[model samples]
Target chain A: MVNYLAGLDAVFLALADPTRRGMIERLSRGPATVGELGRPFAMTKPAITKHVRTLEQVGLVRRERIGRIHRCTLAPEAMRDAEEWIERHRRFWKSSLDRLTRHVESGDKLTLALTEERDE
Target chain B: MVNYLAGLDAVFLALADPTRRGMIERLSRGPATVGELGRPFAMTKPAITKHVRTLEQVGLVRRERIGRIHRCTLAPEAMRDAEEWIERHRRFWKSSLDRLTRHVESGDKLTLALTEERDE
Candidate 1:
Protein backbone atom coordinates (compact mmCIF):
# COMPACT_ATOMS: atom_id res chain seq x y z
CA MET A 1 0.00 0.00 0.00
CA VAL A 2 2.86 2.37 0.77
CA ASN A 3 4.49 1.62 -2.57
CA TYR A 4 1.14 2.11 -4.30
CA LEU A 5 0.67 5.52 -2.71
CA ALA A 6 4.22 6.43 -3.70
CA GLY A 7 3.43 5.42 -7.27
CA LEU A 8 0.34 7.68 -7.16
CA ASP A 9 2.61 10.63 -6.32
CA ALA A 10 4.83 9.93 -9.31
CA VAL A 11 1.85 9.18 -11.58
CA PHE A 12 0.09 12.46 -10.84
CA LEU A 13 3.37 14.37 -11.05
CA ALA A 14 4.03 12.92 -14.48
CA LEU A 15 0.51 13.76 -15.63
CA ALA A 16 0.70 17.32 -14.32
CA ASP A 17 2.18 18.53 -17.60
CA PRO A 18 0.10 19.33 -20.67
CA THR A 19 2.70 18.17 -23.16
CA ARG A 20 3.25 14.89 -21.40
CA ARG A 21 -0.50 14.38 -21.18
CA GLY A 22 -0.78 15.02 -24.89
CA MET A 23 1.86 12.41 -25.60
CA ILE A 24 -0.01 9.88 -23.49
CA GLU A 25 -3.25 10.72 -25.30
CA ARG A 26 -1.50 10.12 -28.59
CA LEU A 27 0.03 6.83 -27.50
CA SER A 28 -3.36 5.67 -26.27
CA ARG A 29 -4.50 5.35 -29.87
CA GLY A 30 -1.57 3.13 -30.80
CA PRO A 31 2.14 2.58 -30.38
CA ALA A 32 4.34 5.27 -31.90
CA THR A 33 7.98 5.98 -32.48
CA VAL A 34 9.56 8.48 -30.10
CA GLY A 35 9.76 10.93 -32.98
CA GLU A 36 6.14 10.37 -33.86
CA LEU A 37 5.07 11.04 -30.30
CA GLY A 38 7.05 14.27 -30.19
CA ARG A 39 5.92 15.58 -33.57
CA PRO A 40 2.57 16.98 -32.44
CA PHE A 41 4.08 19.20 -29.75
CA ALA A 42 6.13 22.37 -30.38
CA MET A 43 8.63 21.48 -27.68
CA THR A 44 12.31 20.91 -28.37
CA LYS A 45 13.66 17.34 -28.72
CA PRO A 46 15.28 17.44 -25.29
CA ALA A 47 12.07 18.68 -23.71
CA ILE A 48 10.13 15.91 -25.42
CA THR A 49 12.66 13.35 -24.28
CA LYS A 50 12.50 14.62 -20.71
CA HIS A 51 8.70 14.44 -20.70
CA VAL A 52 8.82 10.93 -22.15
CA ARG A 53 11.33 9.87 -19.51
CA THR A 54 9.07 11.14 -16.74
CA LEU A 55 6.12 9.17 -18.10
CA GLU A 56 8.32 6.09 -18.50
CA GLN A 57 9.60 6.39 -14.94
CA VAL A 58 6.09 6.55 -13.54
CA GLY A 59 5.25 3.34 -15.44
CA LEU A 60 2.46 5.12 -17.30
CA VAL A 61 4.26 4.83 -20.61
CA ARG A 62 6.36 1.97 -21.91
CA ARG A 63 9.39 2.75 -24.05
CA GLU A 64 11.22 0.02 -25.92
CA ARG A 65 14.07 0.02 -28.42
CA ILE A 66 14.50 -2.08 -31.52
CA GLY A 67 17.89 -1.54 -33.07
CA ARG A 68 17.85 2.14 -34.17
CA ILE A 69 14.19 2.78 -33.45
CA HIS A 70 12.42 3.66 -30.17
CA ARG A 71 8.79 2.80 -29.55
CA CYS A 72 6.49 4.27 -26.96
CA THR A 73 3.04 3.08 -25.80
CA LEU A 74 0.59 3.48 -22.97
CA ALA A 75 1.32 1.10 -20.06
CA PRO A 76 -2.08 1.82 -18.27
CA GLU A 77 -1.17 0.36 -14.83
CA ALA A 78 -0.30 3.67 -13.22
CA MET A 79 -3.24 5.34 -14.91
CA ARG A 80 -5.50 2.61 -13.54
CA ASP A 81 -4.09 3.14 -10.05
CA ALA A 82 -4.69 6.86 -10.20
CA GLU A 83 -8.22 6.31 -11.44
CA GLU A 84 -8.93 3.81 -8.67
CA TRP A 85 -7.77 6.19 -5.94
CA ILE A 86 -10.05 8.98 -7.10
CA GLU A 87 -12.94 6.58 -7.62
CA ARG A 88 -12.54 5.01 -4.19
CA HIS A 89 -12.62 8.41 -2.53
CA ARG A 90 -15.63 9.42 -4.56
CA ARG A 91 -17.45 6.31 -3.36
CA PHE A 92 -16.45 7.02 0.24
CA TRP A 93 -17.72 10.57 0.03
CA LYS A 94 -20.99 9.44 -1.52
CA SER A 95 -21.59 6.79 1.13
CA SER A 96 -20.93 9.28 3.92
CA LEU A 97 -23.45 11.63 2.38
CA ASP A 98 -25.96 8.76 2.25
CA ARG A 99 -25.38 8.06 5.92
CA LEU A 100 -25.94 11.69 6.81
CA THR A 101 -29.20 11.70 4.91
CA ARG A 102 -30.40 8.59 6.65
CA HIS A 103 -29.51 10.06 10.01
CA VAL A 104 -31.43 13.22 9.29
CA GLU A 105 -34.47 11.30 8.07
CA SER A 106 -34.44 9.08 11.16
CA GLY A 107 -34.29 12.16 13.37
CA ASP A 108 -37.35 13.57 11.63
CA LYS A 109 -39.24 10.29 12.03
CA LEU A 110 -38.39 10.20 15.73
CA THR A 111 -39.61 13.78 16.17
CA LEU A 112 -42.91 12.97 14.41
CA ALA A 113 -43.43 9.83 16.49
CA LEU A 114 -42.92 11.75 19.77
CA THR A 115 -45.36 14.48 18.64
CA GLU A 116 -48.03 11.83 17.80
CA GLU A 117 -47.52 10.11 21.15
CA ARG A 118 -47.89 13.38 23.04
CA ASP A 119 -51.18 14.17 21.18
CA GLU A 120 -52.62 10.69 22.03
CA MET B 1 -11.28 23.76 -23.99
CA VAL B 2 -7.91 25.37 -23.35
CA ASN B 3 -8.98 26.74 -20.00
CA TYR B 4 -10.24 23.31 -18.95
CA LEU B 5 -6.95 21.70 -19.93
CA ALA B 6 -5.06 24.35 -17.97
CA GLY B 7 -7.20 23.55 -14.94
CA LEU B 8 -6.25 19.89 -15.31
CA ASP B 9 -2.56 20.81 -15.03
CA ALA B 10 -3.10 22.54 -11.74
CA VAL B 11 -5.42 19.84 -10.45
CA PHE B 12 -2.91 17.09 -11.15
CA LEU B 13 -0.03 19.18 -9.79
CA ALA B 14 -1.88 19.73 -6.52
CA LEU B 15 -2.71 16.05 -6.27
CA ALA B 16 0.93 15.05 -6.80
CA ASP B 17 1.73 15.47 -3.13
CA PRO B 18 0.98 12.78 -0.55
CA THR B 19 0.14 15.27 2.18
CA ARG B 20 -2.30 17.14 -0.01
CA ARG B 21 -3.89 13.86 -1.09
CA GLY B 22 -4.28 12.78 2.54
CA MET B 23 -5.96 16.07 3.31
CA ILE B 24 -8.26 15.58 0.32
CA GLU B 25 -9.12 12.04 1.42
CA ARG B 26 -10.01 13.34 4.86
CA LEU B 27 -12.04 16.23 3.50
CA SER B 28 -14.02 13.87 1.29
CA ARG B 29 -15.51 12.26 4.35
CA GLY B 30 -16.73 15.66 5.60
CA PRO B 31 -15.82 19.29 6.17
CA ALA B 32 -13.05 20.11 8.60
CA THR B 33 -11.45 23.26 9.93
CA VAL B 34 -8.09 24.24 8.47
CA GLY B 35 -6.47 23.20 11.74
CA GLU B 36 -8.25 19.88 11.63
CA LEU B 37 -6.94 19.24 8.15
CA GLY B 38 -3.42 20.13 9.22
CA ARG B 39 -3.45 17.94 12.32
CA PRO B 40 -2.88 14.66 10.47
CA PHE B 41 0.61 15.45 9.17
CA ALA B 42 3.79 16.15 11.17
CA MET B 43 4.60 19.23 9.14
CA THR B 44 4.91 22.88 10.00
CA LYS B 45 1.87 25.11 9.73
CA PRO B 46 3.34 26.91 6.75
CA ALA B 47 3.88 23.69 4.87
CA ILE B 48 0.32 22.57 5.51
CA THR B 49 -0.98 25.96 4.47
CA LYS B 50 0.99 25.75 1.24
CA HIS B 51 -0.50 22.36 0.39
CA VAL B 52 -3.99 23.61 1.19
CA ARG B 53 -3.38 26.64 -0.97
CA THR B 54 -2.33 24.42 -3.85
CA LEU B 55 -5.56 22.40 -3.55
CA GLU B 56 -7.69 25.54 -3.30
CA GLN B 57 -6.01 27.06 -6.33
CA VAL B 58 -6.74 23.96 -8.38
CA GLY B 59 -10.39 24.13 -7.19
CA LEU B 60 -10.29 20.58 -5.81
CA VAL B 61 -10.83 22.09 -2.34
CA ARG B 62 -12.87 24.98 -1.10
CA ARG B 63 -11.73 26.88 1.98
CA GLU B 64 -14.00 29.31 3.75
CA ARG B 65 -13.46 31.59 6.70
CA ILE B 66 -16.12 31.23 9.36
CA GLY B 67 -15.58 33.64 12.23
CA ARG B 68 -12.07 33.01 13.52
CA ILE B 69 -11.74 29.53 12.01
CA HIS B 70 -11.12 28.50 8.42
CA ARG B 71 -13.03 25.45 7.18
CA CYS B 72 -12.08 23.22 4.27
CA THR B 73 -14.00 20.65 2.21
CA LEU B 74 -13.62 18.69 -0.98
CA ALA B 75 -15.01 20.78 -3.83
CA PRO B 76 -15.47 17.75 -6.17
CA GLU B 77 -15.66 19.71 -9.45
CA ALA B 78 -12.00 19.48 -10.34
CA MET B 79 -11.90 15.90 -9.19
CA ARG B 80 -14.87 15.14 -11.45
CA ASP B 81 -13.16 16.85 -14.36
CA ALA B 82 -10.02 14.80 -13.77
CA GLU B 83 -12.07 11.62 -13.64
CA GLU B 84 -13.88 12.53 -16.86
CA TRP B 85 -10.65 13.11 -18.75
CA ILE B 86 -9.23 9.76 -17.65
CA GLU B 87 -12.46 7.95 -18.42
CA ARG B 88 -12.69 9.50 -21.86
CA HIS B 89 -9.14 8.55 -22.73
CA ARG B 90 -9.62 5.09 -21.33
CA ARG B 91 -12.59 4.63 -23.64
CA PHE B 92 -10.57 5.91 -26.58
CA TRP B 93 -7.77 3.51 -25.81
CA LYS B 94 -10.16 0.59 -25.49
CA SER B 95 -11.81 1.36 -28.80
CA SER B 96 -8.45 1.59 -30.49
CA LEU B 97 -7.42 -1.77 -29.07
CA ASP B 98 -10.68 -3.29 -30.28
CA ARG B 99 -10.04 -1.95 -33.78
CA LEU B 100 -6.60 -3.50 -33.80
CA THR B 101 -8.04 -6.85 -32.76
CA ARG B 102 -10.69 -6.70 -35.48
CA HIS B 103 -8.07 -5.82 -38.09
CA VAL B 104 -5.95 -8.82 -37.11
CA GLU B 105 -8.99 -11.10 -37.11
CA SER B 106 -9.98 -9.95 -40.60
CA GLY B 107 -6.48 -10.65 -41.80
CA ASP B 108 -6.77 -14.18 -40.43
CA LYS B 109 -10.12 -14.61 -42.23
CA LEU B 110 -8.55 -13.52 -45.53
CA THR B 111 -5.69 -15.99 -45.06
CA LEU B 112 -8.16 -18.81 -44.30
CA ALA B 113 -10.24 -17.96 -47.37
CA LEU B 114 -7.17 -18.11 -49.60
CA THR B 115 -6.05 -21.40 -48.09
CA GLU B 116 -9.51 -22.97 -48.66
CA GLU B 117 -9.59 -21.72 -52.29
CA ARG B 118 -6.19 -23.36 -52.95
CA ASP B 119 -7.32 -26.65 -51.41
CA GLU B 120 -10.44 -26.69 -53.65
Candidate 2:
Protein backbone atom coordinates (compact mmCIF):
# COMPACT_ATOMS: atom_id res chain seq x y z
CA MET A 1 0.00 0.00 0.00
CA VAL A 2 2.84 2.39 0.85
CA ASN A 3 4.67 1.73 -2.41
CA TYR A 4 1.42 1.96 -4.33
CA LEU A 5 0.76 5.42 -2.93
CA ALA A 6 4.26 6.50 -3.87
CA GLY A 7 3.73 5.21 -7.43
CA LEU A 8 0.48 7.17 -7.64
CA ASP A 9 2.25 10.33 -6.50
CA ALA A 10 4.84 9.77 -9.26
CA VAL A 11 2.16 9.16 -11.89
CA PHE A 12 0.23 12.28 -10.99
CA LEU A 13 3.40 14.37 -10.84
CA ALA A 14 4.36 13.13 -14.30
CA LEU A 15 0.91 14.10 -15.50
CA ALA A 16 1.09 17.46 -13.69
CA ASP A 17 3.11 19.22 -16.36
CA PRO A 18 1.11 21.08 -19.01
CA THR A 19 2.70 19.25 -21.91
CA ARG A 20 2.21 15.81 -20.42
CA ARG A 21 -1.34 16.56 -19.27
CA GLY A 22 -2.13 17.93 -22.74
CA MET A 23 -0.86 14.71 -24.27
CA ILE A 24 -3.16 12.75 -21.97
CA GLU A 25 -6.21 14.97 -22.66
CA ARG A 26 -5.63 14.49 -26.38
CA LEU A 27 -5.09 10.74 -26.05
CA SER A 28 -8.31 10.39 -24.08
CA ARG A 29 -10.44 11.08 -27.16
CA GLY A 30 -8.81 8.10 -28.91
CA PRO A 31 -5.40 6.50 -29.40
CA ALA A 32 -2.85 8.87 -30.99
CA THR A 33 0.33 8.18 -32.90
CA VAL A 34 3.40 9.83 -31.37
CA GLY A 35 3.81 12.41 -34.14
CA GLU A 36 0.12 13.22 -33.97
CA LEU A 37 0.42 13.75 -30.23
CA GLY A 38 3.33 16.14 -30.76
CA ARG A 39 1.81 18.38 -33.46
CA PRO A 40 -0.04 20.58 -30.96
CA PHE A 41 3.08 21.39 -28.96
CA ALA A 42 5.86 23.76 -30.08
CA MET A 43 8.48 21.32 -28.77
CA THR A 44 10.19 18.64 -30.86
CA LYS A 45 8.89 15.07 -31.13
CA PRO A 46 11.82 13.86 -29.02
CA ALA A 47 10.83 16.17 -26.19
CA ILE A 48 7.25 14.97 -26.40
CA THR A 49 8.49 11.43 -26.62
CA LYS A 50 10.35 11.96 -23.35
CA HIS A 51 7.13 13.17 -21.72
CA VAL A 52 5.26 10.16 -23.05
CA ARG A 53 8.01 7.90 -21.75
CA THR A 54 7.65 9.44 -18.27
CA LEU A 55 3.91 8.83 -18.43
CA GLU A 56 4.63 5.27 -19.54
CA GLN A 57 7.07 4.81 -16.65
CA VAL A 58 4.36 5.70 -14.13
CA GLY A 59 1.77 3.41 -15.83
CA LEU A 60 -0.60 6.24 -16.76
CA VAL A 61 -0.14 5.62 -20.49
CA ARG A 62 0.85 2.62 -22.62
CA ARG A 63 2.48 2.57 -26.05
CA GLU A 64 2.07 -0.02 -28.80
CA ARG A 65 3.32 -0.11 -32.38
CA ILE A 66 0.89 -0.66 -35.21
CA GLY A 67 2.96 -0.78 -38.39
CA ARG A 68 5.55 2.02 -38.01
CA ILE A 69 3.31 4.23 -35.84
CA HIS A 70 3.46 3.95 -32.07
CA ARG A 71 -0.01 4.53 -30.60
CA CYS A 72 -0.70 5.61 -27.04
CA THR A 73 -3.77 4.94 -24.90
CA LEU A 74 -4.82 5.87 -21.37
CA ALA A 75 -4.00 3.35 -18.63
CA PRO A 76 -7.07 3.77 -16.40
CA GLU A 77 -6.28 1.43 -13.51
CA ALA A 78 -3.62 3.60 -11.93
CA MET A 79 -5.92 6.60 -12.03
CA ARG A 80 -8.56 4.49 -10.28
CA ASP A 81 -6.06 3.47 -7.60
CA ALA A 82 -5.24 7.10 -6.86
CA GLU A 83 -8.90 8.05 -6.84
CA GLU A 84 -9.86 5.21 -4.49
CA TRP A 85 -7.14 5.99 -1.95
CA ILE A 86 -7.99 9.67 -1.82
CA GLU A 87 -11.73 8.99 -1.61
CA ARG A 88 -11.29 6.49 1.25
CA HIS A 89 -9.22 8.85 3.39
CA ARG A 90 -11.30 11.90 2.54
CA ARG A 91 -14.37 10.06 3.81
CA PHE A 92 -12.51 9.33 7.02
CA TRP A 93 -12.10 13.07 7.54
CA LYS A 94 -15.69 13.80 6.59
CA SER A 95 -17.01 11.27 9.08
CA SER A 96 -14.76 12.63 11.74
CA LEU A 97 -16.12 16.10 11.14
CA ASP A 98 -19.65 14.78 11.19
CA ARG A 99 -19.14 13.09 14.51
CA LEU A 100 -17.63 16.25 15.90
CA THR A 101 -20.64 18.17 14.70
CA ARG A 102 -23.05 15.79 16.40
CA HIS A 103 -21.10 15.83 19.63
CA VAL A 104 -20.96 19.62 19.71
CA GLU A 105 -24.73 19.87 19.19
CA SER A 106 -25.82 17.16 21.59
CA GLY A 107 -23.05 17.21 24.21
CA ASP A 108 -22.39 13.50 23.68
CA LYS A 109 -19.45 11.26 22.86
CA LEU A 110 -20.42 10.93 19.21
CA THR A 111 -16.74 10.77 18.23
CA LEU A 112 -16.21 7.84 20.54
CA ALA A 113 -19.33 6.18 19.17
CA LEU A 114 -18.10 6.55 15.60
CA THR A 115 -14.79 4.93 16.51
CA GLU A 116 -16.64 2.06 18.16
CA GLU A 117 -18.77 1.70 15.05
CA ARG A 118 -15.62 1.34 13.00
CA ASP A 119 -14.26 -1.25 15.41
CA GLU A 120 -17.13 -3.56 14.50
CA MET B 1 -7.24 24.83 -13.88
CA VAL B 2 -3.85 23.84 -15.22
CA ASN B 3 -2.00 25.50 -12.38
CA TYR B 4 -4.42 24.00 -9.88
CA LEU B 5 -3.70 20.55 -11.27
CA ALA B 6 0.02 21.18 -11.00
CA GLY B 7 -0.43 22.22 -7.38
CA LEU B 8 -2.36 19.04 -6.69
CA ASP B 9 0.50 17.02 -8.17
CA ALA B 10 3.03 18.87 -6.01
CA VAL B 11 0.98 18.40 -2.86
CA PHE B 12 0.57 14.67 -3.43
CA LEU B 13 4.25 14.28 -4.26
CA ALA B 14 5.19 16.13 -1.09
CA LEU B 15 3.01 13.72 0.85
CA ALA B 16 4.46 10.66 -0.90
CA ASP B 17 7.48 10.16 1.34
CA PRO B 18 6.97 7.61 4.14
CA THR B 19 7.91 9.92 6.96
CA ARG B 20 5.62 12.61 5.61
CA ARG B 21 2.73 10.21 5.07
CA GLY B 22 3.32 8.84 8.58
CA MET B 23 3.01 12.37 9.98
CA ILE B 24 -0.32 12.73 8.19
CA GLU B 25 -1.65 9.35 9.40
CA ARG B 26 -0.84 10.33 12.96
CA LEU B 27 -2.30 13.80 12.59
CA SER B 28 -5.53 12.30 11.27
CA ARG B 29 -6.18 10.63 14.62
CA GLY B 30 -5.77 14.01 16.35
CA PRO B 31 -3.57 17.06 16.42
CA ALA B 32 0.02 16.51 17.63
CA THR B 33 2.91 18.66 18.79
CA VAL B 34 5.93 18.72 16.45
CA GLY B 35 8.10 16.80 18.90
CA GLU B 36 5.34 14.22 19.37
CA LEU B 37 4.96 13.86 15.59
CA GLY B 38 8.70 13.18 15.28
CA ARG B 39 9.04 10.47 17.94
CA PRO B 40 8.40 7.51 15.60
CA PHE B 41 11.23 8.38 13.19
CA ALA B 42 14.95 7.82 13.84
CA MET B 43 15.83 11.12 12.20
CA THR B 44 16.56 14.27 14.17
CA LYS B 45 13.76 16.70 14.97
CA PRO B 46 15.12 19.16 12.42
CA ALA B 47 14.75 16.56 9.66
CA ILE B 48 11.26 15.72 10.84
CA THR B 49 10.56 19.44 11.13
CA LYS B 50 11.58 19.78 7.50
CA HIS B 51 9.15 17.02 6.51
CA VAL B 52 6.36 18.64 8.48
CA ARG B 53 7.24 21.98 6.91
CA THR B 54 6.93 20.45 3.45
CA LEU B 55 3.52 19.06 4.38
CA GLU B 56 2.52 22.51 5.65
CA GLN B 57 3.71 24.14 2.44
CA VAL B 58 1.40 21.88 0.40
CA GLY B 59 -1.54 22.69 2.74
CA LEU B 60 -1.93 19.08 3.90
CA VAL B 61 -1.35 20.31 7.45
CA ARG B 62 -1.40 23.42 9.58
CA ARG B 63 0.91 24.14 12.50
CA GLU B 64 -0.03 26.28 15.46
CA ARG B 65 2.16 27.06 18.44
CA ILE B 66 0.44 26.88 21.81
CA GLY B 67 3.20 27.91 24.22
CA ARG B 68 6.25 25.93 22.97
CA ILE B 69 4.27 23.04 21.47
CA HIS B 70 3.67 23.33 17.73
CA ARG B 71 0.52 21.35 17.11
CA CYS B 72 -0.28 20.05 13.62
CA THR B 73 -3.69 19.03 12.28
CA LEU B 74 -4.74 17.50 9.00
CA ALA B 75 -5.86 20.28 6.63
CA PRO B 76 -8.22 17.97 4.65
CA GLU B 77 -9.27 20.41 1.87
CA ALA B 78 -6.30 19.75 -0.37
CA MET B 79 -6.89 16.04 -0.10
CA ARG B 80 -10.46 16.62 -1.33
CA ASP B 81 -9.20 18.52 -4.38
CA ALA B 82 -6.86 15.69 -5.34
CA GLU B 83 -9.58 13.11 -4.71
CA GLU B 84 -12.18 14.98 -6.75
CA TRP B 85 -9.86 15.44 -9.70
CA ILE B 86 -8.86 11.77 -9.77
CA GLU B 87 -12.44 10.53 -9.35
CA ARG B 88 -13.82 12.78 -12.13
CA HIS B 89 -11.36 11.47 -14.72
CA ARG B 90 -11.48 7.88 -13.52
CA ARG B 91 -15.25 7.77 -14.05
CA PHE B 92 -14.54 9.07 -17.56
CA TRP B 93 -12.29 6.07 -18.22
CA LYS B 94 -14.73 3.59 -16.71
CA SER B 95 -17.59 4.90 -18.81
CA SER B 96 -15.35 4.77 -21.87
CA LEU B 97 -14.65 1.12 -21.14
CA ASP B 98 -18.29 0.35 -20.55
CA ARG B 99 -19.14 1.95 -23.89
CA LEU B 100 -16.40 -0.04 -25.54
CA THR B 101 -17.79 -3.24 -24.04
CA ARG B 102 -21.27 -2.43 -25.32
CA HIS B 103 -19.99 -1.48 -28.75
CA VAL B 104 -17.97 -4.67 -29.01
CA GLU B 105 -21.03 -6.70 -28.07
CA SER B 106 -23.60 -4.88 -30.21
CA GLY B 107 -21.46 -3.91 -33.20
CA ASP B 108 -22.52 -0.27 -33.08
CA LYS B 109 -20.98 3.17 -32.58
CA LEU B 110 -21.26 3.09 -28.81
CA THR B 111 -18.08 5.09 -28.41
CA LEU B 112 -19.52 7.79 -30.63
CA ALA B 113 -22.72 7.74 -28.63
CA LEU B 114 -20.78 8.06 -25.41
CA THR B 115 -18.98 11.12 -26.74
CA GLU B 116 -22.29 12.56 -27.83
CA GLU B 117 -23.70 11.82 -24.39
CA ARG B 118 -20.96 13.99 -22.90
CA ASP B 119 -21.76 16.80 -25.33
CA GLU B 120 -25.13 17.10 -23.66
Best by lDDT: 1
Writing each residue's lDDT as its tens digit, candidate 2 over A1-120 gives 334456766765675576876776666665566777777779987898898898889898888775676767677687766666666666667665564456547854633433332221
Per-prediction TM-score: 0.78, 0.73
- After the best TM-score superposition of candidate 1, give how far the Cα of residue A6 lies from its true spot, in angstroms: 0.4
Model 2 Cα lDDT, one tens digit per residue, B1-120: 334466766676765576876777666665566777787778998898899898898898887665666757677788876676666666667665664457558854633433442321
- Considering every candidate listed, which one attains the maximal DockQ? 1
Q: At residue A15, what lDDT does model 1 achieve?
A: 81
Residue-level lDDT for B95 in candidate 1: 69
Clashes of each: 0, 0
Q: Cα deviation of A108 in candidate 1 (Å)?
A: 17
Runs in model 1 lying further than 4 Å from the true structure = A1-4, A96-120, B1-4, B98-120
